[model samples]
Target chain A: MLTAAPERSSHTIALVGLPNSGKSTVFNALTGFRQRTANYPGVTIAPFVGWVHRDGHSVAFVDLPGIYSLSPKSEDEHLAVRFLRGELPDAPTPDRLLVIVDGTQLERGLVLLSWVAPLHLPTALVITMIDELKARGGVLDVEELERRLGIPVFTVVGRRGIGIEEIRRSALAWEPWGIPFLPLPPDASVEERYQWARELSAAVLHFPRPDTRSERIDQVALHPVWGLILFAMVMMLFFQAIFTLAQPGMEALEAGIGWLQQMVENTLPEGILRNFLSHGILGGVGAVVVFLPQIALLYFLLTLLEDSGYFARAAFVVDRFLGSFGLQGRAFFPLLGGFACAIPAILSTRVIPSWQERLTTMLIIPLMTCSARLPVYTLLITATIPPVSVGGVISAQALVMMGLYLLGAGTGLIIAWLLRHTLLRGAKAPFILELPPYRLPAWRTVLGRTWSSTWAFIHTAGTIILALSIVLWALTEIPPVSVPPGTPPLEAQRLQLENSLAGQIGHLLQPLFAPLGFDWKITVAILGSFAAREVFISFLGQLYAIDVEAAEGTLRHVLAQTLPIPVALSLLTFYVYALQCISTMAVLRRESGSWRWVALALGYTFALAYCLSFLVYQAARWLLG
Target chain B: MGQTEIEVPLNRAPLRRQLVVRRYEGESSVIERLCELGLTIGTQLLIRRRAPLGGGIEVEFRGVRVGLRLREAAVLYVTACGDSNAYRSS
Candidate 1:
């Protein structure tokens, strides 16, 4: 029975490989649920570390980002090479290295192996994708390869867990192959190394012919005309799935949280503890939790796309368009993921090789109108825009919602272009992408990856949101004072909120927001929403609960009756551009690895939101009034 | 049979045309990368297609497809092996 050992006794082993080589799958098989998938390429970007126990001792395994060679061209490759050379500060030097090779592309894999060979580290080889190779009528002489390289070679179908135990044993024993370092000749060029790898592969690999299915698929998938169409269709279905499929699950989660809040409110005595648990902890965390379905769906689809080898094609298709904005084609997935949530999207930018491109993508991701803003947008659209249809087809409300989404995306692209010419000016990184052969995505791999990502989000962001929610709750309920006799409960609650710290801060900021057509109540909601965009809706819900006449009315109904159209439109525009989520700022700090960038991002976005909202409000008043 | 091999830029190579890499005329980094990706002299390459709207070119070599920018593709000098029926059949 395998069990996790004490961390102090765990030996570290690093799994290295070329891109698309099934290294991550092998790591998943060895570590089980103990692993977390960071889903990015750099060593520091998403260090996926897992531990496996063997005979009372545990071995820590790190799945490093895939690279083609030791020579670093991109940031990810640089980090990977540095980590392998034990030059990365604060990272534990792996006691051993397990190099995974793609059996189907043995020659290419051998080139990378040769580079690792000169390092003379304690290393072994696990040849993967053997099933795909066998399907193409190929056979690899694993024993012969082991003899030629003087290393232990294990053949594996990582997706199905074949030969996982043997690899585990090899890691546990910490056996170095002791293969003599095959040093590169002085002044040897990449061609010479390629020749060497070719000779090595010729010695052990036998295949009747190249696999034709992948070629056939690529003909359609990479065709300039049809590929773009296919990509668009695939993306359309992907977004539709996220919106439609996740709807029921999101609703269920929301209802479940609401029920829990009500239960605690009813069962617990009415006190600070009850208030904190029901409103602060439950409400704040629930806002983040309801988004789990969308996040999970996004990861699941992305994993499938990645596993099937279509993502590279998609990147290739979009390279030209993204290049104009000073972003690499690889930034497409992260930006698309941004539509679901910016946190995972920022983490996903590790796939971009250039530091500038990755940073630019991170800066613009929050502008992608994440699902968090949906509730706010929906509420505003419902309250302000009529349900009248144009030509009996498009609803005015739906059009406004779509326009807001486009506004967010358009502003992001324009900013990307501006940043590229000014702050991020440099020669564009040369585009060199390898189109991996298409394969059927394994179900277990996709599910395991999605589960790990969902767990990571809940574990990391959930705690911060919960803590902030509690702090906000305290701010809303301070300076213990009772309502005066004969005062209406609604007015008393309003006065209590107005007198609280959160309310006072809102009042202090009212003058600043006055230009944008927001009153103190709206100002308070905006401040509260800094914890998360969705919090704006919940905060409004709480505020409306104070008005006895409007207490029984829905928050949307109350807002519809109260706020003028210009103010409502202004607020909608504000949410479109504001960096109103603390979790996003926290994620930015972590991903960019600096507070300066976070502060700059926060400062600029707030300014942009305020200026834009003020302009929209003033223009609307001039045009309509 | 050195009949003054007719060389053309890789980007100019017609789709599905088989050619042999003569030399890379690009920057050192591009040359190094091309060599690392097994596009060294004497390697066979088939131009798959030009990306839509002049984005890049897709070249097939060694059972793999590599997408290269048009400028990078222009640096590769290839000698067209006129109508290699045997290569196509294979």
Candidate 2:
């Protein structure tokens, strides 16, 4: 352990369970919103630790990863076992442990119970999914199972928050340790476990007999071909839905921002403060307003998928394709979330076990059409690509939108393949999926998480970006233009941002960027956008406002009008291959242990962006000209 | 029939007899998982539904809904007894 807290207790309870066995719901039930501390070591798939009072004393319930055994193969599985064994930093072994099992599938869920019993960590069992067994025509001899295992068992329907009082009661009465002796002999290896799983299952489990029409249909649904297709469609629908539903709200936001900017303009004095408030603040802030709907919607959709168990299906579908590039099936969920933003997505990669796998997953996630890319795409598509109806079903612009998404996917795969072949070469992690059972989307859970994420984005735009915009405005506008007496000040030199420190620096770096088609103004915007992508829009907004003579839409129109098609295309391509967001870099620093990987990532991406953009522009013009 | 004999025995009149997965159609991460879960051709499979909407159908493998794409599902050869018993059926 690299660190431990000064006031830490020597006891921690790690909740272990199989997927969809109500591990999370149980945590929520026990925690009930009072949980704040993160449990998983180095995993941002951080589960909430809801403190419980057992018999007038405080006990912390740590929700560990959902796994089936102590014979750890994957990182999450290993972590779950390790934390229980008191290996993780500041993570202590439980005074009492709860082994949550599926009420319906005790045989399978008990796979872990049998393995971990010998290790002896104050074990008890909360058999979940009792409601489902009733719904699906299966019966559980709960008392018999509990007596045989020599542990207390409580039946729970975790979502309704049911049986939790009894759970608390058991926690209070728990011996602070348990000893479960198997009537049968124990096998140690995975090979032994596999055989034990079969033998033990035959002894205790009785699967609901499959006879009805539905069973046959499921056989096909599980089919590789059909399943893959369905998976693709689900993702396509999600992306299509995110963009589709966001447009109207996005338009309303644009109107609202325009109105707000006009209000600021009318109210403020026509000076540095006013320009800062109106053009710098409003323009920069307004760029994000158009994207709020998409961000909120994407977060909402992704949280639901992650919570409701559909992500597992989608992951299985793409697992094959991702494998070709050296990523595992687990990367699917992270990339799926990356479409909206990379913050949570990158954080989620902690659930990925291997550092190499996690790095590959993290690196590729930013490519999946993040909501940041939305404003740029919408701006370019509206300006350049005309939306014409194709075949009365597909919009030309929609097709182009699909192509852009595909391009991101293509680029991500290529990068992963490159990493696999070059810097990171090892056996691809074996695919292990914990397929959670189908369940209704937890609306409360989803909404709380989604809104929290939305609020985080809002907080970022309101603070960091807001402060930076003000600083940028000042950087571009200081020294109060001392013009020669009597000359209405040469309009160009009165536009003397050159006198300002920003313009001088922009001019200095102009030569290096010239080949990539970036003029001084574009270079300035690029530098500002390094802070945030949407800052590009405001960068142009503020730059043109500096020229004073440039009209509304003049900067946007300037790029469209004055810049060659090659330059505009180059800028677009540059953003397409743009590396991590600033926040992504910070998180990567925390995760990767050094800035070297971050620099390598940025250097490679920049070089890739420049070469790719140059080739694209030169080729497009050659083909057209 | 010869191909059917390659993996598992087919039911009489090609009834969709349950078979555990022997292996996946393609050697990918997904196929490997399906095989590990006793969802191969010989394992007893409960064919799920082709969702009324698009995407894929749901299948019950080792008592879980394994949602497979149309392409993957197609390679799966099954002996169905003219029953519409899809996955998720009561």
Candidate 3:
């Protein structure tokens, strides 16, 4: 909320760490709520930056992807190197780098410092996970290590916000030399550098008995049988948590959006413009926003698992399946995460050694049911499938929904199998994965990380959703034309939207859908819903907003008034089959660096959906008619 | 039911008893993966725990839970971690 341009006196600080090094937790503590999220050039991995104002200076702290070496392989790794080299788009090179190392893994994490030290940048080692180490009879001679390294090394345990302020102050106070982590003379081979680093570590470092929890956890968690069970149970719990806990909040959101639409209707002058804004924009776009709770909750649970070390074992559990699918075993984690959201999932696919596996995983990840699809599925199922009991143990409606989800998953797997033999077919890729030791769930770190990610979704991605909603609203509301209609559209279309251009287009698209049971109204809604799957509800909300059948239960009846039951089932089935998600497309473009793959995927899915729906509807009409 | 006592055909189901690895009994790509993880002879393995949806099995060895599919788990032999009923997964 600065009214004027702030002074360009802010200095950038990069926070670097090894995987699972608690660096992100400290970054969250320092930045709090001030941050920006965007994609790195030529890659999907989004780097984050946040501001911390201390004393009189604005300090911008950046969280870079964790890596073991300065050498680049993955796009994210390349971005890290480039940024360290003072080259990045939309970002000035950092003034200093903070290398955070896990104290328990000091031997391994210190390898990064040798590379960083020679660069000659003013660097500090934020020794993290110290609390875990201390509880396990481990102790670090921090002063001695600092004396040997000749850098201001701060001992930290950021999950609890401990030692965070100290590190920040030290970083703010330190002055830097011109050089950073430069290599030794050209005559010296890598062996010489390794020798020097090992000698230095031996002279200065102290390691008491390191915590063995990770090893113990790894033994049980990564075991051949039990580990797999625990991993699945954990993932299933996360999936179930989203559906179970986020429902009431979703209802509230739906109600709120509904109330707002009503408010806009009552306040605006009665015309196509007002009707279009309320029904088209608010209805079409607002529906997608309702899924924010589910998305946020999903991220919360995922971040929780990731902060703990259980996630690695889960990947280990599925490594064989990934290998069978012609994907690298490491591809399992990112693809599993793709079931939640594709952005982080695709970005994390960097662990895959080959581009083909990464591309294959990305192509099929959208086939996994994302939260965007959940809203539409819920709306449709509630409308069609009656709530009933099955042997008094299961909810019939719930079972059907679960079955549909399984169907999507099964089909996605089958599709991947087919693709492995066909279009992108290749020899199965090799696997190289790091199975890090497990740690206790740091709930504070999980919460902070979740909040940061959720904030990004709301501010950056959510705004794009909103803009699309507004444009969709205009499409459905303008034109003010006569409806050459056989069926009345949903509530959003009942307003003066009947005369708008969007309504006319919807009217025109009606016949293309009539065979599958939709009239002009449903056709219009589905057409705009192509941008996102879950928007089907809000699209209907906007479409139905203009109609009298704006209430929830009334929508199905309204559709039935136009098309037969067979057609409704066909539409539902079509939604189930077609890979209809905008986020999925964005991720595909990111992973492949080309839109061809996405276009091909979209074409194949839509073609398959239409063919299946057509056959199912026609067969049903012949029999059930 | 120990690795030394139970010697079933390589394709048949693994015995209920836990076993110590006498040796990796195959030479396919899958075996190469196991080799990469340093799963050699004298390694203790129990294949009782597994994921519900054909994900894999959990074998306890050197105090770590390693999840491997029956495809690979079949390659290991062992005595039961504990005396129990047959481990049948859904």
Candidate 4:
């Protein structure tokens, strides 16, 4: 071991272990709210770092991604190994290592210990899940294990904070001295190492027969036929809960934002400031913020699924289907979450072990028809498709909506397959998922995770959305034109909007969209809606509301009367395929850690939308004419 | 003893049959990974269940449950410990 002077004021210790070893739970207990979780294997990934106050000094704990061995076969494991060697750029070499070993599966953990122990760092072992071990009538001789390994081994029930303080104190006082090396052949094969681990485990660990509860549960959870049925049912309920539970909170937020906008309108004098405040700032930002409850609910349910150890089984159940698409089984949850929103879905892709699979999943998640598209779909369907009942039960409009959703999902899967073969061609990573024992999710951990993700969403992507909203507002507000006398108020407003910068840009882009049967006004709405897809409805509302006195009906009626069937159909198809949401772009950039991906996603989606919409419009005109 | 031992890919093993890993038939790195998961030569594993649609197999080893894709499981060579009659019964 290399000796170096230790920094007194603060120290960094990396928490390393196998996946499902409760390392994160221990980190959360030590660091409280000072931690941040992120994708650890991606291009822009970073280890989760949290600070804890111990004694008089502040200690920062870096929670590296879990891996079974230092010799990594997957990208996540590679990252963990790199971080331990202090080779990661901008990451400090940890002064000490806190290796977490699962007490119930000591032999598996000992293999990892044999790998890490040779590094000769100031290391300590924290044996977690001891409660599970004891519940199965097992006992571990920690003192004897400590003697064998020459490291302080603390038995901790991390979930319940048992023996945590003693571990914390020992970790804080860790020094690179008196650590004995295990006696092994200098050139030990992995099999030889495993043999040594087994012998050591036998010396210090004693247990009754293995508990059969998890195995019994696995019989049902892993059944070839019933498992898939159970998985589908569970996922269906999960997505349903995301939509149903978050609806009230979403509506309440909308009302709250609407109230705030009204107060601003009533209080402020009518001017550009009022318009910018209500429409630009509040409206633009509130549009994204209203989806927070849904994002939170999606993450909350996902955390529960992951914590309960069912996620691994779900992955196992879906691996074959996912493998055919060059995706991993873990992509199932993230793709399912994409139906609610793509931002959190992208964030949750961290669970996927392969970087290639994760990126492929990220690129395709936006195509899952997020909730943000509902408003635009509803507006177009309400205007174009009448409420004729099919079989006296289902409405034709509802069927059309369902058809659009199916189209989006179908396109997403096809594109994922295509990308896998083209841009992301590589050998499929090996799948070895650990099915942790079933346990009720720690509510505190779930809530904490949900809160952090929500906050991170608002803090990082929220600002970008706010800025784009302001920019869009300015685009429509600038180059004010004078209205002639005797022009009605609504007509004057329309004239001003037509002469504005946004309108001019719309005219410039009109020729491109003209093939899709879109007018300049529709083009302007499309441009403004780039802030978010749902903004398309409000933009159309504002544009159509201009001819209020001259129009004989509601805005919907006016839109229906003015737009031909071909044009309306083209517009709906465009919105269905278009990557128009700035927040999603921002989140994608953040998650992938590459502006290149963001540009590629935007370019391809726009290209697809334009080509498909043009084809639809031409076909409709040809058929109807 | 070696000639009499019946070896098969782990993925082909019957459910509920106990097997002892003899060797891995893939890349050395793959073998190393299996060893890290306590599936080294001489380690005992019980075949739990195959996943739906031939996705993977669930196995119990070292008091933990592990899921492996069919391709990875196929690389693991193991010998059934009990009589052939017992394996056929399951």
Candidate 5:
């Protein structure tokens, strides 16, 4: 046996568990909230790493991806096993292994531990969700479990902070950790290991009742007819709530920004600084931030659905439909998330167990017409389409907006099908999803997740959105035009924009976009929008310098007068199919660990956008003429 | 019909009825995954219900609920428990 003890000053500990085993809750409890996610070298997944300072000896806790066993079938499973065996490049082999198991399902947890025992790492067991187990009238003999496994056993109700500090103190005292006894022989077959785990768990645990509540819920949730109806109703209520609930908050934020802009205009001198502060900073970031209400609410409801265990049943219900399109039910989550923002949506795709399905979902997510597209769609539709009711029911503009959303989603499904058949064709991975027991979601965890995802959006807005806004401001305002003193301010701003560098580039690119009926000004907006779809509205607002609200009469009259019906229709079509978010592309690059998908996504989306827009423009022109 | 002749692939196993895992009839990798999840010869599983439009089967075993796609579930052959058809450890 090796005699060297782990360094006394610091230690690296790894946490592993099966999915939905409360591993993350324990990790959060141990590490607090100051966790940093680092992508493993050459891998598509990034595990959370955090540091806990105890008694002046800092312990770095690595929350490895959740897996059922150490088998290397899936990429996440492969990464976990590789990290455990010190085979993952650049990642330190953990000094000790912290295995987490669900208190309710101790047998399966023990089986997982059995898989890791052959490595002979100094290991300890953390049994989480003890509160839930006890609520079901289950009892666990923690001391007996420790004795049988020959390792330190800790039971934690991670949500309530019970038995957490003890784990932390034990982690700090790392040297005396026992080498966990192998639950089964190293060469034992899977069946033997499970039998051993069953016997061992039967000895140390007793549960008098089953999770009948989950079964009762699943009967309706997974029913052939009622399940679909419940799913549809849930989705409808969810989106309806998002729009209605977020409206007032959105208006408040808009008013808040307007108030701030007024203050900046009043305080700052009338020059580039004032214009930059009002239009460039507030206008750019504020436009994106205005949607935070919708995003936060969307994530909140999604967290509730997920924590209530309804999300898995929803996935099961939709599996056949998505499978027909070469996707899977788990793809539903990311696709739904796409309606909010593609960045977090792509991150959420980590739950998908298969690589091809996950990548397919990520690639097509931008086609879902994210919240960023709403402003653009609203601007164009209100400017062009009349508010007269279609068939005396839905307004024409609202109908058009709904049609655009359908077009985006339908195209995404078609593209997924095409890619599945051509580029990403592979045998479907077995879909084995564990339906966790239904419980009232912990409010703290739900709120924490919602806040973190919302924060991610704000981070994107601060960096990418703010940067793009500034760049567009520079491009449109540089080489200040020399207008006569009597020139009107609005006219002067337009002249400055037309004479700026962006104007020259727009003119240069006009011929390329002319087939889709885009003039140089619209071309400039499109070019700026390549960084972010929402940037198009800000760019157009700047180019027009129409101080009034964009959806109001003045800007609408200006747009309707400047562009014919055909051109307006074409631009709307282009926005529907275009992949307009560079931030999403960057995330794709990072997640896929290759620039190949990024290039393909950019290429195909642009081509599809151009062709579809050209066709719409020509068709509308012919019909109108 | 004799219980022995009524053995069927797990995908066709009757819903909410206890069935015994009889034989491994799937690819090795798939069988390994099933074993790891505690589905082994002679182990009993209760078929909870099929998903909407026959997408997958939810099986309950060892106090756990697991959903398996129809294709994946077809790999295991199971017989009704408490019968001669049920496999006995040799």
Candidate 6:
């Protein structure tokens, strides 16, 4: 749904620029509309589409993937080239073009412009980072550039919102804008086009000094040993912030959900409506929503790192190690994002240029212990493991949690190695990444992206999760059984559940899962968790007739009493390896563009889950005996 | 004089030295990408810094900095031209 095509507008402008040319900054500054992710039919990583409205005029602008030239090489660049030429099906051909150029790199920008000149589209030049240029003793004569290229030129500082409104006003008036005049022949060679760009740039742009500050920073930031140390420090800080900084926010959200549940209970009468409202709706969604703090922080920190230009250096630092494993440095971000949520992490693998490497990266992302699995892991560890300190340093429960994370990450690496050698093996693609100059992160962009990603999470909770919760409620509540009027509430609920559709399905699957030490009730909750990992806790709460909001303490107590240590450990092992998230599978299908790969991924993960869980259960049983 | 202009792969080129692109011998896709990034023949480039642990080398040309893996860099043949300081604006 996020990548649906944009609504057609009367007039559309396509924004084209090289990567790190501040193209997204300009798009974010000008467009007030909610951005829609645009996925062209054969494109793996889609462009962004948004609308700019002013003075009763609205123009849809598609932000094409950053490309250095129109000559198609990569899949996304081919899509960009085709989209500009009106060749892509199911996507509207743009009416005009906004050619964005980095103020500091006019010559390189002109090379790209040279390719676009032949398209004969109504093109206007947008010069970003003008401030960075001037600070470095560079001169860009916008009027001279306009005269030289026969294109309207405007300079804007996207970070500070400088001249944004003027660009918005003129973006809709492309009819009178100057189209680039190509002096060279239509069949000019690459060398000739570059020569033309060089002459044109020399005439209009001048840089008297190099970016000494960036070079100085890179001395340490890109240093072999120090650079790696710094990279590790940054990663440590990132994960540390996610856990420490998000705690208070998570607690507040939990308390808010608890209060809302209380309000609903006081207002609604005792019956199906009350039970559904408090336990079904609130319980199911609240469990997922509590992780909102971690999700928001993850995107916030990632955006900051990307905008500040440190991510590229980190990738550079790790390229050798990751390359040894048949994955490139760009895969690092998606794998790290997997820790927050595999849905977004899988989406992020688009940065990798190679199809084989990208597929390998995507296949391993679900094994990285996403935040959705955190609640399930915590519950099991708290229930099965003792709280005694390990060597008087860390609690055994904490140690178990850390061990599970390491296991997930370790297993993901091993599988990546295997996939690279077997199913997805291919020659490595060229790793040529531009390292943009570091600058202060734009707060507006950071906060906006955080809100959008967080909003996406809420949307998921409201739709897919809500629908699944309703289905779970219906499956457990239907075919209600009669009980004595004086019977206990918990017993009555259990009786009704045993007769419901879910109970029947669970009974059917229980024998299959018996090797893993799971009972019928656990089978039911495990099945419900396929919608999302966090739903397991709510399902267990529902089956036990406990309010999920306040069930954390009681649920742990109840689980410890009802479940043996072996079963709990086995279940934890299952979650560590199972591909349980439907949303993740959906994203994997869309990204890989093949349901066959999805089936393969599902098969492999399920096999791993079953085999490891069976082994753990049997070993535990033998040890206890 | 022609013999004096020895060509070396960019990955083996000395750090902070200005070099001219002689030719690229690699996969067509890789060569095309390099040209599109303005590494066409005769364009002057400087090896700004080499990443630690053989990660890659940072190459600067046309005032744009790009990180290229050693494998990709090894495909680009370059001839040492002038001092890096003299080609500051390349």
DockQ of 3: 0.07
**Which lDDT tens digits does candidate 1 get at residues A582-622?**
88888888788888888878877888899999999999999
Q: What share of the reference contacts is kept in model 6?
A: 0.85
TM-score of each: 0.93, 0.76, 0.79, 0.91, 0.92, 0.93
lDDT of 4: 0.80
Evaluated on CA atoms against the true complex, candidate 5 attains a DockQ of 0.62
Over 4 Å off in model 2, which ranges?
A: A1-11, A37-45, A52-57, A172-179, A183-207, A210-229, A246-296, A306-309, A350-355, A384-403, A434-436, A448-502, A546-555, A619-625, B1-90
lDDT at residue B47 of model 6 (Cα atoms) = 93
TM-score sort, best first: 1, 6, 5, 4, 3, 2
Question: Against the unseen true structure, what C-alpha lDDT does each candidate score?
Answer: 0.82, 0.64, 0.64, 0.80, 0.82, 0.82
Write the number of the candidate with greater TM-score, choosing between 2 and 3: 3
lDDT (10s digit) by residue, model 5, range A57-128: 889888887777878666667777788898878887898999999898888898889888888889999999
User: Superposing all C-alpha atoms, what RMSD in Å does each candidate have to the true structure?
Assistant: 3.6, 7.2, 8.0, 3.9, 3.5, 4.5
Which CAPRI level is candidate 5? medium
Candidate 6 local lDDT, A451-521, one digit each (tens): 66566656644466666667777888887778889977777777777778888899999999999999888
- Model 1 misplacement above 4 A: A1-9, A37-44, A173-176, A180-187, A485-491, A548-551, B1-4, B82-90
Error of 2 at A543 (Å): 1.2
Kindly list the per-residue Cα lDDT of model 3 for residues A1-625, writing each as its tens digit: 8588544367888888766777788888777767666565754556788887766767788888776566654566666777777777766678887888877666545656665565556777788877877876666778777766666778877767788887667655545422333335533433344444445555554544533566566556655566667776887787678778988888898898899999998899967777777766777556556767776787787677767766656666676666676665566656666666655566567656456777777767766666666666676666665577899999877887787677667777777778888887886543334455566666666666677777766765566566666676666545555555554544324654545666677788788777777777677667767666665665566555533344344665554354465775677667767766665566577667789998987887787678878887899788886
Each model's DockQ? 0.52, 0.09, 0.07, 0.55, 0.62, 0.72
The CAPRI classification for model 3 reads as incorrect
The candidate scoring highest on DockQ is: 6
Clashes counted in candidate 5 amount to 0
* Candidate 4 clash pair list: none
lDDT of 3: 0.64
